[model samples]
Target: MPMTSTPTPAMAKQTPKQPPTPTAKATKATPTRKRPKLCPPDVTDRRRRPAGRIAPEALAAERGSALEGLDWLGRPPEATASLLYRLLRLVARFIIFVVFRFRIRTSGQENIPAGGYFLVAAAHRGWMDPFLVMQALPSQPRCWFLGSAPSTFTSRWRERLIHRLGGLLPVWRGGVGIDQHVASARAVIANGAVFAQMPEGTVSGPAGLIGPFRTGWAVIALRVDAPIVPLAIAGTEELYLGRRMVSRVLPVTSARALAGLDHGAEMPPPGTREELDVARRMSDALAAIIGPVVESIHPRTVDPVEHPRRFRRRLTWLFLRPGRLDRDG
Candidate 1:
């Protein structure tokens, strides 16, 4: 076996001085994007509009088609009162007074303006409330009603009958074609005929429990410079034979008075904050005036014993829309 030679320090080849292994340059981290914050349904954001309310532009587009075949707006109220209207009104009177035997007691007939046009703002409790009001008034100058087109024109016959009646100014709720409705109402009031409307907007709530009154009627009254007669109706909520209904007409509320203006003062321009303020004030005033009368006549709490089960469901079914009675209030 050969003995191995011990290698000297110099004999070991110098390790190659290679370039330091390149350290990976610290990679700049890419930032993750943040998601947008979502708001809850109940949260009212100033930047966003409330749901279910139509934007003004979309409402404008709908107005044209809404009033398209409603030629009655062009004619005066008297022109549309044909023979059919008179006969139908007579039949309605017979049904209300003779068939149903509803004893209508009225007061404040003196409060109604003698000659010029005015508005009758009432609480709508039943389907026959309008006819009851018509019966309460003098039959010479028929009152034109601002009726919901959807509710009033449910069938083709109803639409034709309403059109022939000549006293209905059909309005699309939820701000559809409101301009045309206001215009038609103004024309009706200007023609020396009374215009009537339910400020509650619909037949909701129990008798004497008036809903929040809408300001649309106030707006129309202001525009036409007419007085709003607050008419309180009770006992029409449940109709039956020998039902006694009372209609009381409160004092007249003039547009000037409602706007907080003195006689001979000009009204605020339409769509102005001042005009809206006036409308709200008028609505509140009318509600206050009519609420007490309603409550006095027909209290909110009913004694089940007094209102018997006899003909209750059947009578309610006869006058009210099926499954749509808004008694929840």
Candidate 2:
């Protein structure tokens, strides 16, 4: 028989009992810590962090820009016009200023530039738009306006006066005489004065609703590498072509208008989608100066608008051009 050994009292005393496992109820009762949200607790304040204060460097840059603008203004005109041009400009300025007593408020006039070539892409609200923009300037700088022919100077006397004054040049739409129109415009800028055109091609309204821009202005800007200044003319919608002559009959307050200039936005590569996109953007800038009057009357419809295939490529579009329509249906 094999000998059997029994454990000693000391060894038995060394063994320890295991602790009990937690029950399902106990585990479920424990609270879990949650991860914090990235955004602020108050949705209204939305900012995750405090607004950044303007840096000193930014302030210095602004001052430098202002100084540069002054230097530009002090520079000489690109080219001088004849004495006759000067006299005509002065007379027209006097008529608009002293006679009509047109009151205008302007913002961002500094963007007119110091020298060289630039074009004003004005939003046409009524016949007086060109006159309003021209007179709004602090200095009466001579500008050649591109007008629509057959319709611009309807009467013989009006035609003769405009021709003699050497201010208005006609641009025939529908591909008729477009080249000549462009050439004449080039000549004007070559002589140092600025050229202005109502890019909307027609009057939209006083409230600043702009229509499609004609490509002629964009082509000119690209060819000369000239900057295009966006100009918005407001408060002259009531002075439509029919009412312009008798505008003085209205209260002096009705003659008041506002024009705002947006800093020059350089033209992108010519003939590219960017060209059309930029022109549209400039139209939007011109609309801002018209104020909220028109908007209140015909509040913009929130419905979606359809656009052409070419326009779809624009990354900066708010949504198909505001007034675009579907190709079919």
Best TM-score goes to which candidate? 1
Report every candidate's CA lDDT.
0.68, 0.46
Over 1-329, each residue of candidate 1 has an lDDT whose tens digit, in order, gives 99999877776666556899878899889999999788886674557542444333344365443442234455666623457777887898887788766678788888777534665545676677887677767775678887765455545687676676677776653444356666766676666667788888767666666778887778877887876677888776676666677778777778787667899888889878888899999888777778888888664323345654446555544644454323332
| Segments of candidate 1 deviating more than 4 angstroms | 1-74, 79-82, 299-310, 317-320, 324-329
RMSD of 2: 21.8
- Per-model TM against the reference: 0.72, 0.48
Report residue 242 deviation for candidate 2 (angstroms). 17
For model 1 the TM-score comes to 0.72
Worst 10 residues of 1 by lDDT: 320-329
* Tens-digit lDDT string for candidate 2 (178-289): 4455565566566666666665665553344445555556455544545455554444543211122111001110000111223454436656776556645544443443
* Model 1 score (lDDT): 0.68
- Report the Cα lDDT for residue 78, model 1: 60
